[model samples]
Target: MKKFAVGIVSAAFILGAGTAVFAAGTNNSDNGFSFEKMLPFMQKMHPDQPSRN
Candidate 1:
């Protein structure tokens, strides 16, 4: 019973530490998707459609 408790505690600690590290390492600078960036390609694909700009 003691060993099982220790194992559970250790597993929880490792998981918590890993999650913290992953959260800290994330980048917040991503611009994600931009319709303006895809505008030229979209215009080429369908010239008849009016642009939203």
Candidate 2:
């Protein structure tokens, strides 16, 4: 039981750290915008754009 708990904790820690690293490594300014991050500009530029399923 103790080992299982430790493994779960370690896995969570690793996933969190990997996410942070990945976010840090992203360009964040590609194509003059980060579509995933800048919603307002996208709305203005492509108001007619259809929503993704």
lDDT of each: 0.79, 0.82
Off by over 4 Å in 2: 28-41, 44-53
- Range of the 10 consecutive residues with the lowest summed lDDT in candidate 2: 27-36
List model 2 lDDT by residue over 1-53, tens digit each: 99999999999999999999988877657644576768877778899998674
The runs of at least 3 residues in candidate 1 whose Cα sits more than 4 Å from the true structure, single-residue gaps closed, are: 28-53
* Pairs in steric clash, model 1: none
Q: Tell me each candidate's RMSD, in Å, in order.
A: 7.8, 6.3
Q: Note the residue pairs that clash in candidate 2.
A: none
Residue-level lDDT of model 1, residues 1-53, one tens digit each, is 99999999999999999999976665343554455576788899999998766
* TM-scores of all predicted structures: 0.52, 0.57
